[model samples]
Target chain A: MVTVLFFAAAKEAAGMELLRLEVSQSLSLLQLQQRVLQLVPALQPLQSLLLWAVNNQYAVPAQVIESGDTVACFPPVSGG
Target chain B: MIQLTDQPLDYAAITESVRDPAAGAVVLFLGTVREFTAGQQTEQLEYEAYREMALASLQQLVQEAASMYPLVKVAVVHRLGVLQLTDVAVAIAVSTPHRAQAFAAGQWLIDTLKQRVPIWKREHYVDGRVQWQHPSQEAAVAPVVGEAS
Candidate 1:
């Protein structure tokens, strides 16, 4: 299972801070994004602007996301 | 030292934490909650972070800055939760053997953190409107600004 976290505007869009999704095996982040949207469609509007992280590190859509990892969805950072 | 906190930021403590006897200069930078954006009055701001990632990103920035400037010590703290205008929302401190190095490292740390950290800010205007501040989502949430609160 992958623990998916949402932060900032993305959290508001998703309407929850986080959720756990069961994954049969490792999948690419792009594929995971699709699966997540299937479960949380509210995030669709913000998809283009979202940033993704896997296991606390920035990852590309093609990067593998294994079960038991933590995936984060957020917008471009604006922290000082 | 790097952290994300819901409590008020103690910038003086952050600066002191990075002080090193062997370093000739220390530089500090604080990002405060501003009162205005454009002509609209800002009542306050709320900060949020993807905790684990934000902390890791801050540590990486410190390490990167150290590699670039020979930093003696570094501390960064970013405030989460609500903050009123003029409150310090973030603080970064670095000590180096020279003033130039310290200043350069301090600037780089703040600039890089803003771009790479997994933290976000929500602006609350005096008119009761709220907006989230992603670089591209500047106008995403709120209606047009009106008279101040």
Candidate 2:
């Protein structure tokens, strides 16, 4: 299983903070994002804007994502 | 000390924590929720973060700053949940051998944190409107429905 986490504006869009999906094999971040966007339609419009991370570290779209990894998605940060 | 707290920030305590006998200067920075922004009156502010990542990011930023500068010690605190106007949203404290270094490090930490950290802020306007802040946006607002609290 891969845990997908959302925060701030992305969380609002997803309607929940996190979800765990059963993944049979490893996938790229882009593939994972596509699968997530399909399940959470409210996040469709934010596809290009959401930032991605894996296992609590910032990640790129083409980065490899494995089962048991925690992936995070969020909008641009504005903290001080 | 790096922390993400839902409770109020004790800036003085944070500043005190970084005080060192070997360091000649200590700098404290408090990011407060202001009442106005470009003539728009903000009633309150709500802050949230990807907790684990946010904390890890803070630790990395501190290590990076320490390497770039001769930092003696550093402490950072960020508040989550709803905050009223004038509330302390974030606090950063740094100690260095000189005031200049302390000032420079403090500023860089805040600027970098604003851009890189996973924490987010939502502004509650006096007109009963609210929006999520994306610093890169040009007056754009992200509308929120359910309360995340």
> How many Å off is the CA of B55 in candidate 1?
0.8
Q: Pick by lDDT: which candidate is best? A: 2
Clashing pairs in 2: none
State the DockQ, from 0 to 1, for candidate 1.
Answer: 0.42
lDDT of each: 0.84, 0.88
**Which regions in candidate 2 have their CA more than 4 angstroms from the true location?**
B138-149
Candidate 1 backbone collisions, by pair: none
Model 2 interface Cα RMSD in Å? 8.8
Clashes of each: 0, 0
Report the lDDT tens digits of candidate 1 across residue range A1-80: 99999988888889999989999988999999999988999999887787788887887789888888998888878777
All candidates: TM-score: 0.92, 0.93
Report the lDDT tens digits of candidate 1 across residue range B1-149: 89899999888889889888889999999999889778989999998888887887777777767668988999999999999989999998899999999988889888878778878888999999999888746533221112111
